[model samples]
Target: MSPKNYEIIEHSRGWNGYFKLDVYRLRHDTFEGGKSAILDREVLERGHAVAVLPYDPVRDEVVLIEQFRPGAISVQKTYPDMPLWLNEIVAGIIEDGEKPQDVAHRETLEESGCTIIGDLEYISRYYVTPGCSSETVTLYYGRVDSTNIGGIHGVVDEGEDIRVYKVSAEECFAMLQNGQLCNATATIAVQWLMLNRDRIRKETSALRP
Candidate 1:
């Protein structure tokens, strides 16, 4: 249903930073065929982002990066053993007038030093948190050669301290299974590759350089 279906009683704005928050007061249709009472909701207005998983089908290897995330520390505060640094796929925000594919390629190079070998195979586009966030992420699987794709790489000005890892696809799957790949994007990417590895290998074998 269109958002027009809701009666916008009021709209307000909140924090503005890397993301903005908006407050909405509205009411919508009900299953009983009557409009409900006004309800207020606060939503984090995070812009869309793109994440790409680099895989070398022939070598059976994958490129991943590890970086510290302060958000994780804030959320999982009770667990003292919780790892603040997370292993994740290459990802970046879509800059003004930039496409998802462009960000994917740029992030892959900056984070892991692996250039995307061919056209990206789209995996999924999804909301990271719909309950109170407007952030949506687009995912892709990019073919890459995993040879010598390990080191520290990232934009110094961005304060990004990234460590790249080139691991066998089987080992990556194991990480996913063992909770090492706890981030949402990495988990989803690894799961999709696990199910489609053979077909992907066959389809991209000839495309390898």
Candidate 2:
């Protein structure tokens, strides 16, 4: 699929902030024929990140986080009922030379004060918004002990004020069906958990730590 059938007619920098936006005047291979017209498109270089859903199979619970997302507020006019503070799985951006697994564990502890132990199960790697943003999330499922897992945790310097909580796996599935887990990352992770919960619970190695 990596064919040299596309041309970058021209590209210019648009924004050089937290997210770098670039305007591209390019043509790419078309499904029906040769190439598309040199149409202009703006792409945001948001970089890649990692996510992890920490589960306590013994307790049948999953750790979750709540935070205010300015991006959601920015789109409030279009979706007037959109919420500002959203509940989601723990996640963070991957720095240069950092592995996705490492970032997953790091974010879990940073956001929820829970350390992921035992075998880490990989869930998925996907683009959050491929149409306009170059952001992708590598998702995982990690084992944890939720005996005393509850807090509001996050790096103060990062301006991240995160509230952490745990819920029964059954309740999480219900939330998924009712659109409570609205974010793509949380939705995907919970849906996967719904299908694989039994197997995960049966894994003695996964219920420890």
Best by lDDT: 1
lDDT of all predictions, in order shown? 0.91, 0.89
Q: Each prediction's TM-score against the native?
A: 0.94, 0.93
Quality of model 1 by C-alpha lDDT: 0.91
Off by over 4 Å in 1: 1-4, 207-209
Residue pair clashes in candidate 2: none
Error of 2 at 71 (Å): 0.8
For residues 1-209, write the lDDT of model 2, one tens digit per residue. Answer: 44358899999999999889999999988877788888899999988999999998888999999999998977898987778899899999999999898898889899999998776898988988899988999999998888898888999999999999999999999888887788999999998999998998888555458
Clashing pairs in 1: none
lDDT of 2: 0.89
